[model samples]
Target chain A: MPDDTTPLGAPLTTPDGFVALYRREAELVLRFCTRRVLDAETGVDLCAETFAQAFRSRRSFRGATQAEARAWLLTIARRQVARYLKRGALDRRAREALGIVTPVLQEGEAEEIERLAGLAPLRAALAEELARLGGDQREALRLRVVEEQPYPEVARSLGVTEATARARVSRGLRTLAASLELRWEGERP
Target chain B: MRILDELEREIERVAHAAGEARPRRRWWRSGALLVLAPLLAGTVAVAATTGILSGEPVSSDPHAPRDPNAGIGVNAGPGKLLAVRAADPAGGPEWGLRLVKTSRGLGCLQVGRVVDGRLGRLGQDGAFGNDGKFHELGPEILETSSECQQPDGAGNVFFAMTSIGQPASADPASCAVRPRGEDKRPACPRGSLRDVFYGLLGPEAAAITYREGGKTVRQAVERPAGAYLVVRATDPDRRDVGWWSPSVTPSWVESIEFRDGTVCRPDERPRRHGRHECPLKGYVKPRLDIATRAELATPITVRVGTAREKPYPEMDRKSLERMEWQRRVTISFRARRAADARSFYKLTAEIPGRPPNCGVGLGSPIARDIAAGETVTETLWVAHRCSGTMTIRIGYEQQTAPSQMPFHGDGPPNAKVGTARVRIP
Candidate 1:
């Protein structure tokens, strides 16, 4: 991180900083991209593209804390994922010519980690429950839990207040838990 | 126990991964694109300009004159330059105004460069009366501020007396540059000095005039009301250059003082608490004319609406019905070709209100050109209690037309044009 005196300097060294950021937050970024793209390799590519963009624009980094940095990084990742959706694979070739690769999150390691954390079973049920909810509610839950952003920051990104952000997440969690209960009964119970 | 042990193992593994990812290099090279961007941009701009200059044809300036229209004895240099005190005053709070006498008796008044409040000049004779007079108009001592002079006094500096019959007060002690010279018109010293404190402050001043029976009086008035003098300079070629002060209501001016040797000063400052003569009625009517000649088949538009076409009836029926009343409104035309000559067209709208009328003045009426295959728009008002249908009879007369059919012609009068009536219900 830059010392207190330097207003213009980056918060941290470029390459190491981005790699550390990837290692710390890669799985969350992967899940975010997967939720939208529905393919493993595409998700990995999007995640990498997000990091590559973040690295190039490091001059604009303005994070006060690690949590803030994670929020900013996720915002960048979301933009990269949106561009990927807009242009598709043909755009990938154009982006490559521009020296931009839409990096993908490797599926195996992220899946294995989620399984070990006991979140693997929840993923499909959560996605279904989230899709059923209103747009704002689903966005709040994804940003707070899956992306691991703080409540106030998510509220700001969604143009809402902290209390509203927290309330949406809580309501989404309850609805999700009820949906999972029904799914479990329909399957193995 | 097995599940708990698995959770602990997973947490440990995650910790190990995160610790290993900690950065080893404190410094990393930034992307390659940034380093050579300036050099690449410079090369491109130079090449593009070179290409443009090598191939493009040189052309004369379109606005350049075919014939020189230079004025005799007029040098290309700044005329009648004033320093326009770009800095704020040093210490005092009193606002001031300054003016230079013109060859004509009335001079151009510059207000609001020195102080806060504003005052105005009598524009014409009898504007105040047959004999111009000033009265203690608005309220007294609205606010007080420090009046300052320049440490290195450069220009003519003066202060506003509180009223026509009051002692001129000095600005407060806190004002940085105190007036050190004699009370008479003081000269500001040259070069930088702290007597006026630090740098330039504000750019505002005021000039106020008042009449105290048997004497013409003037003062440099200032107010903390933070008033302004907005000067709009109009450059009408060499023939004319004029300035107009933004119109302000009389109630806004708070103080008045006469200059030295004017019969309107007292040893003591007086309270401002009286009314002055109200602005007079009737406006100065401007004279105008319309010129026409033999031309093409196209019709030209003229504004019959003149300054005399006041909304508040310019003439009563007794006065207007007997005399042929005419007014000239200003209009502009574009010349398409030298051969395609044009002439002025005249139109007037007549309507009757109460005989003795008082209303806001008439607005300017616009004119239009009649292009072939294009419709012309004209405005008309209905005269009351007479004809329910309004008929606008447009007529034209050419100086070159023969005695036969002097005013009217069958097919768009060659060397003459005449009017046609369009009925409005």
Candidate 2:
């Protein structure tokens, strides 16, 4: 088995390392495509294409962090979205030529796909609510939640104290929840 | 239930294939190259065939590269040419020049001049020979020169093109005089000219010069009756230009009367923002009235009265049947002789201080046309949850067209406008 404590500089050139990176990032990349395409079948195909391209370019990746790897995959996904917008459909002739078959979505998968499709409108509403917050609070919340940045880095970027950054993120989230009528199951009011 | 697992397996298969193939470049790159290469090659070939690559006079073949700058002059007006001159600074005699009047009431000028090496191609803004191509000059260039002479007669204007920075002289004798009492064509219609003026000055126009087809023509010919005229008024402080049509009345204008009460005509106000007050008398106003029911309620229960005492008589029964909970309230309103002369009134209602979904209900007729002195009543159902003095706003709108529903603009001011409070319980 490969060592669990791989060096930071180690590249994902081996099949095991590539698979590990894929398992960590594939669901997120798939969700990103599903939100844009709004169709489960096509989104799965796009997800497959994104991973295929990422694997082909794995030897060329120079990132030293998992965040960099995720960003690289997201960049590829965005380019795929641009191509889909321009052509109105992803070209699947190459996949067909390679004898690759897309997976059929089962009955229970429809609800998950529909929930993913609803994310776009929900995010739009959240953005409108976010715009009503103070500029610092909005920026802190965006960096911490939407961008998934660590609170310390968010604080450094916004030039605020770590506690202030946490406070802003907390207040911003509470306000957005109230305005959008959203409730987190495990969260206290 | 296992669709995600299936997708993961599929992705793994594709990724394994991709790893084995190890393609050096994206497939779409090659496809794009295959499509764009031919187009790029064709563009280069066309550029080389035209003298665009090497500066030379274009070939005379009809298919030969045509000068981008040269084209038939725009239609001005049907008028006899009075004069023609070359006005060359190199002391060369004038070349062949003739003006023909077209059947569509436009005067077309044709002139042929020798291409002299000293007079380089006329560049933009009177700048000489930046490029080999002859460029059209903007009208501002003509206004700066005092040597360029104007044509004579009541509505005669000169049109000419010369080398950059050179003024073309006009001779009155070279102009042919129209025979006395000959029927002359009326001036070019002002509708198209007014459109051009608006295009130049945009929405905030203070003043504009009436020029036709990028030429320095200042002639104002007679406009036929009922034709639109774009007039520029001058005062010591400022100048303004606006459109006026003698025959048609503007939709907003009620009427126009002269100070002497001699001429009274219905006029339509131009749809624009500017000083449009004309030198005329009083105007008429639009009349509108609206009436409505201020209070209403939802029917909660109906009495059916025992239905001949339910054959069993052992059980004491009530006479009333409780209906399902209803949230809708009926509202009726009438509009009379609305200021807007349009056919229909678009109606809408809203409950202030409530979420958009809270006011959702059915049965409001979208629009109804009420004739002059005739009243039209419309009922709409609205849903609201709040009780006690809920403010309900009813809007009556007159749109330019019947199809423009849910009118966006506020209807005529004071056209039966009022708000009322109603009990929701």
Candidate 3:
């Protein structure tokens, strides 16, 4: 492990540490915040605020591991996103202030590939079918797929046991597969 | 499948762009010292002690201390403390300091400026700095300015330097106290809420306290709401009570009685220490946070309840209206600190009146006192009914400065209900 004490002599300056920290984690933080909130520009701005806060409270770090640092910073990002919600995104000023500009959902080549590969069609059919499942099963799929978090992490974060998490994912996936098969057959000539 | 991949890639791309585009160096001068110096030293020291003078093979610095600061230099005297400019025009009462922890053991700094405003600490690890709009850290950052301006930042920013001397302690009791009189009276409800309302709303001086019983004996409890209601202890006879008032509404509420068996009550009296009135016991209030449905809700509807394959069968609006349905919805809330008491809050739907077809089949009680920086979520159930616009109303009552619940034109004679509209299937 790198010497944790190194930051002690690091300029202890806001801009310097901010630049370093941002370079290291801004992308992940931005992507995470973007997924949580609406727009990318706002995500950028939130990224700035997250670092600015990290800069201000530099004293809170206890020389933990790099992974721990990432978690700490990400945790802060989470709170900021939550605050955005509290202030009510529906309000015009807040929306503007937070840079919550919703970017147009443009179509791209990757989407075309999935469509051609049949995975896209399968997933859609699966999703539609998945909706036919219970809330727990659906939630399992959404958390695992959309959030892209591991089942264990998702379950822990959502306050459920790992087994329950697996069950939700299992049940959801099964329903999707069944639904996709049925839909595909119905569409076949 | 393709759309998800594309979305993920786009997200990653933008995130990467942002990471690359960020300023390569720290903006604030003081923050640089604590975060960067160590890394540089480790490299230099490793190079020097290795005696690579004779073109020796570079070896990992085995002696490098576990912590980089182990061999780093320290400022001869008090370090250069970063100063922030106080909000101009006082940021219009919506401004305060934003503290982020970059290094451990950073001393607490005081806020300074002649805004004639209040200061409190943000109780939670709130996020900040997205396009200048920062996250809410709750109201705990409102402590006294530890030091005045260091002849820099134009005194807008306060600093903490041993050389300069400790920042003067502004009585937290006074600083946290809301200027509104009627609102503050509830903790020590000696005067009528009406009297304090008019007296404090204006420029006149007043204070209030809103305190709840502590979960434990040792942990000092914070007041319950935002700046609206604070807890303070004061003499019963003295008219020291003042309510924490929000800019929006100014009606005093003592307790909230929900449909379930939950009640949230704020202290009604102020406690005093010597001549200065200290904040009441349950003075620390929890900052409110709301997560919108669309923020977390998905357009696709899923089946709920039942063990069958079609627990949440897709039903057109008409079909949903036709069926006898039990709709379940989940809502989550977080607080910066412990609340005054169990909030008997009500959730209101935007749809006016009970629609002929829509009705709340069941509702759960959220009576737990939320601690600061904690997130809590609960699910609520309602029956689907064929009706015009279907909505649910959620409100809470507490003896804080005043209530944030909405006033239904159809509330009880003396009831105030805050409404949060939800879509009914």
Candidate 4:
């Protein structure tokens, strides 16, 4: 992924050319925001607030190439993973305004970042259906099925995931709201 | 350490302390330019005993005539530099302005900021390095030039806009927002509002097309320059073309063809591309980039690859009514790769939204036409304001032959007309 001409001649708003573009896209934006929030301390806190908001807009990186500075640092780690799945938590204000700490994850580090981002077989097939849900309906299915796009733009625009379109729109709006009693909101969030 | 090497050593220590406090905001604006060169010679004689003589700021920058108090030597009046520099395609600094003629004879306009690319450095101290000259913003902005030297109001290029991401108040001016955590080293380099027009284009100005948010909101003037420095990034949540002041006249600039062939009316208002005329030799226009160069980190290549669509049964009252208003998504565009109608085209498709979307996503329809593999199917409604990646870009234009607008050097009006980046995912 470093080949298609990542030669990039300096001037990336120099800080030693954005530390060589933070060493070629900081582990590909730390396993792409740790496999989109399957968590590794929230993928090292959204790869340190996406390289501290790409080093505070490193003079707004307009690229000449290095695959446009790795698609401008994975579009700022895909908008810091869509603002951490629409704020379930972990924004850490541009990585605590550049103090940037958050590492300490060694020992099998979130199964080596979900096994080098294969995402440990989708976290072991969603860990037996998230251990038959309970722990507040699995943190209310990661805080109510993040809609209005971002579960990778509703799983790359519906070809699935916001947990299979929130499990088939909560089983097709719970069988059309149990024969039309209505009330379909957050399906028991 | 190792949050990517402590976020690459805290971004090379805050971009090496904002690239070394922008060259010592020149010993703090060279002591407010010797306490404002005796307060801009007593505010140019209290702005000629107060009639508020209309301002129009402009002063050029080849890397600035080595700033020994520049341009007719800091308002001893008589001036020059309408050469026009305008570079910031986000490489930062390069915005030349200067229309000076003052000492009260009137016609002043000195806007500065010109590091002249790759920050080889210019505007060395604050208020855009006055010791080098273009100054006139009154009361030396906390000792000037770490670049972007504004304030210069002798009056007239329509200033007064300071209320929303700072920078713009001058026309009988006096402004200061300076608040970035009370000085962590900032003399200049504070920016937000950037409409920046930068003048000097009338030697029969042969080609210019404006339009940064308008023509009922973006119709395509998408960077067709030859008219100096035309900046604009707006969208502090699109308050109808995000505050383009002076009673919203950019009228999307539309067109301005000149070089003795005359063209001006797409709705007119580039003040008719500098109005004078006649010297035509070696014409090389068409470089148009400002759409913040499609938010950098390029390459997507017309691939449909992801962003599929369908499924969002009332996606949470449309994501809380898109945090209160602005949501229009309709993109349909059926295909056609030309076999007829003399390959005519204006095939625009623009989704250009970045940062949870601010504006752009609904352009297609310049009566689509294409040749040598043509296809055109259109619908266009696109505002889906938020959610990260959106870059649509169908753009395939070609029109540049207004009699070859005088020897035109062409290239990049969306690269001769072919760019396809689909990202919405």
Candidate 5:
């Protein structure tokens, strides 16, 4: 921890601060990587790659607080996720170069990630939030977010213009984002 | 199972190696990164911090109030921060904002945030650095703060903002994160954690409402202070954030609902209270093809100079529609009269766009003392938002005093000896 007079955030210039950041945010990045691509093993690779990339460009980080750090990390992680989705597989260049190990998911680890991601309870809250939105919004969210379809496809499916489809999905997602505020502590059932 | 442990060691190795490779730079601050960060993430943090920076109006310490943290109000006689940290409408579980009241006659606004709260980081660095959330990390540990410089004590707005930043301390990557092997990783939520505007509305204020993202937003102030407005995004987060280059546009306030209510426009609490002319029906921001020329009263002449783009990183703008807007501009003044001696001269650009009251008004004028008949070129940035036959009229004046020797000093020289215009198509 920096002294009271020292700047607010972890300097990340030192090894300890950088590692502290990883120890702090690795799991969230793991979940982000795993849930987005829906694979535990790939999530592991992404987690490693994300940290490696972060370490490489640690100086590029300017946030003095952990919030800014995480936001910065998430941007990198999101790009990592985006890249993974864009390509068929994770780009292991960063991880491989760093000689980081990608752990195999134990038998139940995959299910654990699903649970950690809180997809079930999240679905419940989402359903509630979705139910509250207009039908057009809900369907638009379903096609764009759930199905992960492009705006054009969503628009065609909704028999609306692409712009209208984007509006619905955007509105739906925003309303649904409120669900993020909720803690998914429910059971597997 | 041991993924993070190894990664932790690896992180140490790399961070150490990289830290050694490049000595830590003292110049870099979180604000720079926040400016570079995505609109939602960086701007939200910045906007909140900026609100806080709009320091309270009162300057000159309040005659050593018995308790600085005592409950303060409008008539409290040069009051200070109240010893209160309630869950304001604008605040979350962590973030806090305080109005920069009149202290030493300087309105000091200090905005605070937990994670990406750049302003919060300032407090952390200042007297209130690292209260908590440093040792522990998860998705984020939020702590809100403020930093504001009121324009001649005009903008007396108060706001406390919040955002979900890093994760909790527990490493959810660990399979055994919870009792049932359940991992709760509060990863960065999809879609940026938007901003919430909350703070003490003045005692005299009633309610506030304004326009945001093509929608009219209203926030009614039931109490004297502590009313907030949560501005949520109306658009869906781009699913593929792998690569996105956004063209920033200057956001403006249309009309404000005041006098009837205590609240100010959502953009922020204003220095002046009155209905504004805004939200022009079917308003579309215009883009100007800026053309340049040098109309000067020589021994100074600008050659074929270049215009380089400067990143516009203003702190407030949650309402700006995502459009291709010129964020900042650095116009270069080049003149090589085959030098004799380099002297100092100032350059100023003025524009009167076709339609007035459009984009942001004239940016700060550039003041450079160029020695004529010298092979010299100087580049300075100016921020402007008028979109019509935009004219950049350059004029210069000689300076004798040392105070005006620096880049920004206003003396005489108010004639358009030369003019350059920009076109909006």
Candidate 6:
């Protein structure tokens, strides 16, 4: 984990600074979108738009910490997702004005989204079950899965051993699976 | 796989666009320091010394000639006038003079460097058209100007009257501004008409033949390095010639056997005709490999089908058509490991054709791990269109270490383990 007090040597207001930020944060942003959208194609498009919007307004980014910068980017991504859900499609004109080349959806992507839509209620339940886990376990799982960090790095960041990190992830997955299974069985009855 | 590749490319594109949109402050700040400092100092000094700080219009001398070219003198160098003719014979004297005056900044006799039977390296001297007289010369006219210079060494020097227009494309190879017209009048005083042939050929060529105007000329190659060969013919004047490399088979030859075991034929079209014509297209075999010995714990056998399939519904037709076509290929492979340990292999497939447009998919490399002695069959979608042969090559590499974070820069080098090639129609 980066020291919270460490200042960003160069601000992201410049193009080169923004490029460095993109290189560091793009994969994390993509993984976040993938988990939310449940489809890789839509997730990739949203990631492009997210960065495009961030770049256009990069001068306005006044954050001093990496966490604040990340939070700022995620806020933009959340708005992008909301707009996408509300409009049922991406804003082509807005993307074009910002020089983003919009990608066409691949085959079966729409169908995948529709299929994942049916599990919306279960997703809410899963979120609740995730909150039920211990704070350490939840944090470990979030770093390893959502942020897509490696085990050793996640362990070091969370101030735990590799074995402890692995155990927390395993326990979290098992708990989520069990809760989902119980929910499905209850619905069947 | 294609979607992943497109996604990676999109990320790069968006990052680049964002960078381009931002204003570059460093360049402007540096430029201001370098330019403004000198200008500010000079302006302050001139204003203080001359006492002309108040704004006033500068007056011009009434006796000066209004024409920009009035005082320009002809300076064609010390070389004698070997030969001079209008650069554009069809444009007549008036158009030629106008072009020469405009291009050289003054109408005068222009000299050029005659290299390999071509005229270039133009230098001008004296005003010619300003006097409203077209300088005509018969055979053997002497030019005695000290300003006229020749190309370094033994290169021949040529001269031509100034013309008004320049060639549309200034690339020397395609430019048509030849000396003394295409009829081949002597550019140098000593009848230096020659034919120059220059081009690259395959390393296998043993000899080349020049066939032009009912005459045949041949040259032997001492060493073939697959480099450019320059064949010159000392004919007073000749521009058209047919070049043939007998030992070098045309790419369209499709099928030709050599005693040295070189495959000089397209694998797909063995019996195609027009073997004498040049091949319209070519292919580059992709690099496929498994990186290191530890990753190669198991022996793998890969088989790729030769048949072609239509593109999927969501795949853009116009995009595929630009590449010529799309071919869905099926790849099957079997791997067997001695130990029960898990192993991962990287598979890369590249179809040589038109590159995908912005936001279009180009397939990504696949990294999959299989159990010991397990066999997996997978289908790969590839773009399949080109005027020439389309080649598809696959390689496998093993992932030795855990993937790094940020994942932006070049990946760890992978050692190639196995490769397969498939050509499609």
TM-score of 6: 0.24
Worst ten-residue run, lDDT, model 5 chain A?
A180-189
Worst 10 residues of 5 chain B by lDDT: B241-250
Better of 1 and 6 by lDDT: 6
* CAPRI-style class, candidate 1: incorrect
Model 6 segments beyond 4 Å from truth? A1-20, A31-42, A102-189, B1-5, B14-355, B359-425
TM-score of chain B of each: 0.20, 0.23, 0.20, 0.28, 0.29, 0.23
lDDT at B229, model 3: 20
On residues B119-166, what C-alpha lDDT tens digit does candidate 1 reach at each position?
A: 221111211111121111111111111121111112222221111101
Provide per-model DockQ scores: 0.01, 0.06, 0.01, 0.10, 0.11, 0.05
**What is residue B232's positional error in candidate 5, in angstroms?**
30
**Across residues A1-189, which tens digit of lDDT does each residue of candidate 4 receive?**
667666676656555677777787777788777766667768876886787777766544545567777887787787767655644566554543343345456566667666666676555645655555544334434435533333455444555556765665444434433532223133210
lDDT of 1 by residue, A36-145 (tens): 55555566556555655555454345344466666767887666665554334412222221222132223364554344334555567667778999888899977886
Candidate 2 has which clashing residue pairs, if any? Answer: B77-B106, B77-B107, B78-B105, B78-B106, B82-B175, B249-B268, B250-B267, B250-B268, B253-B269
TM-score of each: 0.21, 0.23, 0.24, 0.29, 0.31, 0.24
lDDT by residue for model 2 over A22-95, one digit each (tens)?
77767777777776555666777677667666765565464556776777788877767656643456744233
Q: What is the per-residue lDDT of model 6 for residues B1-425, given as tens digits with 9 covering 90 to 100?
A: 34434544444544443333322122212344456445443432112332222111111223232333112222223322222222222221111110122111221222232222222321111111012112222111112221111111112111111111122111111122223222122122112222222222323434344444566544442222222222132332322211111111223222333224443334444222212322211211222243354554333343444455554443345433333233555655555432111123344444333224332222223323345456755565443432222232233433221111011112312444345555544
lDDT of 1 at B173: 14
Residue B34, candidate 6: alpha-carbon lDDT: 53
| Docking quality band of candidate 6, CAPRI definitions | incorrect
lDDT of each: 0.33, 0.37, 0.33, 0.41, 0.41, 0.40
Point to the candidate with the largest TM-score: 5
Which of the predicted structures, 2 or 4, would earn the higher TM-score when compared with the native?
Answer: 4
Question: In each prediction, how many residue pairs overlap at the backbone (N, C-alpha, C within less than 3 A)?
Answer: 53, 9, 134, 45, 79, 31
Error of 4 at B267 (Å): 19
Model 2 RMSD in angstroms: 28.3
